[model samples]
Target chain A: GESVGLHLPTLSVQEGDNSIINCAYSNSASDYFIWYKQESGKGPQFIIDIRSNMDKRQGQRVTVLLNKTVKHLSLQIAATQPGDSAVYFCAESGPSGYSTLTFGKGTMLLVSP
Target chain B: EAGVAQSPRYKIIEKRQSVAFWCNPISGHATLYWYQQILGQGPKLLIQFQNNGVVDDSQLPKDRFSAERLKGVDSTLKIQPAKLEDSAVYLCASSLAWTQFYNEQFFGPGTRLTVL
Candidate 1:
């Protein structure tokens, strides 16, 4: 059984501060991990992704760190803004290409301006 | 390029009622997926389709849920005798290549279904 889960259900951060959201997975076979942001009524938008071969990957203002040894993943947002206030989710897909991603219970990131 | 398209934007029905959702993926995308997102929870994979064929549906509740992708482009998901727990948003997404390593998934405005 493959399942991805998150640590926090909600996080509040002051504007311009850094925020980190954590996740844990039960499947070691997962090879690819992705972070997504969902606003009030929008679909999950891709933020960044990291493969099992790497420990960290950086995107525009977001970073995804993967720890295969512990089966954990984390998403970091720098200089969090009001627009960044939303629910963030971490998803993982197994090594088999074209596999469905198992998503964790999302964490609501509230940025207080 | 346009993203995935889904409708109607909102649906409300009573328990044990039947409801259907439609999705049109991005042009030229080979893979399409359906997901169910309950309030305050992450999206769960319901089904995956590689073109008109099924790729993965292990998590889908086959007893009351059924989906089809005709002509390998657009798809429809139907639920029969829907339960109150079935109340959630149905999201549809598509990727250009199914086997590519870094293919980004483009999503649609999900159909929010409310079962009373």
Candidate 2:
């Protein structure tokens, strides 16, 4: 089933703490996985990506871990800030990188100062 | 560099009416895509194009939906006889290339469509 309503899983963390968001994918053949951050009234912004060959990739303040065996993915944000409050989505590319991306039910991350 | 662009930030229409949305990809991006985002959900790919050529549209409701990218730069998505379930945000995204290697996709501020 798809999440088409206003209710979504929410995670709240205090500023300066580490926040972790998790996602589970169905397609085992997906070639690429990406994490996106979407703020209120704004489009989703790319945070980081990891190829199937690699299990971990890191960016400035974000890290993405891929577990092909369990078909799971997770995003970690260090030193969370107020600006990090937003909805986070994990997307996986279909068979090929050129094809469609299957997104998961997003998790809302709220940071309080 | 400029990011993807879309127009008609918001729209409200009655069921059975028609509507269209436009998108302009970032410079030199050959892959353009349209996605539908329902409330609290991730974006769902509707159509994909590579330099004016259709690559994928499996999820598109062909009966009432149509799209085009004649010059391979800009594109449009149209829906006729809209249904209440058609209410969602239309998002446009582009990537430099859609090859074996994965490239980052840049998305535009979507057009929010409300069907009553």
Candidate 3:
């Protein structure tokens, strides 16, 4: 079945440094993508999202880059902080109008101070 | 505003037993979703409800798993004769409406279930 996946299972970085998490999706028909942050013992929180029509979208200190030609997506966080330590997941939804999301395995991001 | 709410943060039940989890979505939200998230993996949609009607439930184990969203507000997910593989976190989320375009969903803390 078509699915979403990540390049790295875990990413470690020091505080104040930049971090980039990469995801690869197999469904070309998907039109919308979202990045979520899940802390320990909590549900996933929406971070940022990008539509297929756009190549890039930015929110707060996070940026989402979408490459439809390769079916690849990436999330960039500027000035990483300790609070950013969590599992980050990239979810895809779409060719239809409904908002059903298909999530990836997720990449754990560790930010050490 | 309050986010989605779920009950019984944790539950431990033996296999073959029955367990039910409750959820209360954000006020005025017309769409509700239930997802199962196993350890180290991302949340998988189990069912989706538009108002009180089911919109999607293809992934749900209909033989053993059942759900209901009554009054278009609170919902309950029940598992009969639970299996060990049912051990996972159940998350409830709600969106203002179901649209062709993207609508942000607000998630609850989640209910952790352990089927031993």
Candidate 4:
């Protein structure tokens, strides 16, 4: 199975600042990708997603940028808050649909006041 | 709409003991998924169900793990003779049909099992 890994295991950002987390996937066949945020003792929550057909997508205060040419994906959070601190994961899926989401190792985002 | 619900928020048992976890997806969801998350690692898929039928279980260790979604609305996962390594957070998620790319999964709080 192909692997998806984050450029950093942990990231710290100051409150009110923008934060960027990067992920790299090895499978070019992947056509869809999503970002999830997992709070302590809770399941992952959907953040944003992008399809291969597009290079970027935006959600409320969150943005996902995909560079298919490099097989890289990133999540950007605007106005980081302590409440946003959590482990973030980037998952990839092929045209097979949403049932087969392959996850990355994950990055812990710590927003400090 | 109510989010996915899971039971036994936390569990502790000795090695070789058996345990089960339950999950109820959001109303009208047709796709269900089970994943195992070890400490310091991301969640890994264990099984997936589409309606009342299984769509994938390739990563599941059938020798020790078994899951069922009897009526396709709720599901249960069982681990028999659990090992120390089996201690992790088991998460349940639900999505819409595969034909829709707008399908985004909603996850439950998860069951954290500790093997002592």
Q: How accurate locally, in lDDT, is each candidate?
A: 0.87, 0.91, 0.91, 0.88
Pairs clashing in candidate 2? none
- The sequence of per-residue lDDT tens digits that candidate 4 reaches over residues B1-89 is 89999999989999999999999999999999999988778899999999888989999999999999999899999999899999988
TM-score of chain A of each: 0.90, 0.93, 0.91, 0.89
**Per-residue lDDT over B29-76 for candidate 3, one digit per residue giving the tens place of the 0 to 100 score:** 999999999888899999999999999999999999999998999999
**Better model by lDDT: candidate 3 vs candidate 4:** 3
> What tier of docking accuracy does candidate 3 attain?
acceptable
| DockQ (CA atoms), all models | 0.42, 0.62, 0.48, 0.44
Candidate 1: C-alpha lDDT:
0.87
lDDT of 2 by residue, A3-112 (tens): 23358899999999999999999899999999999887678899999999999998998999999999999999999999998889999986777657888999999899
Runs off by more than 4 Å, candidate 4 = A1-8, B100-102
Tens digits of per-residue lDDT, candidate 2, B1-116, equal 88888999888999999999999999999999999999989999999999999999999999999999999999999999899999999999999988977889899989899999
C-alpha lDDT of candidate 2 relative to the true structure: 0.91
lDDT of 3: 0.91
Q: Is the docking of candidate 4 incorrect, acceptable, medium or high quality?
A: acceptable
Model 3 clashing residue pairs (backbone) = none
How would you class the docking of model 1?
acceptable
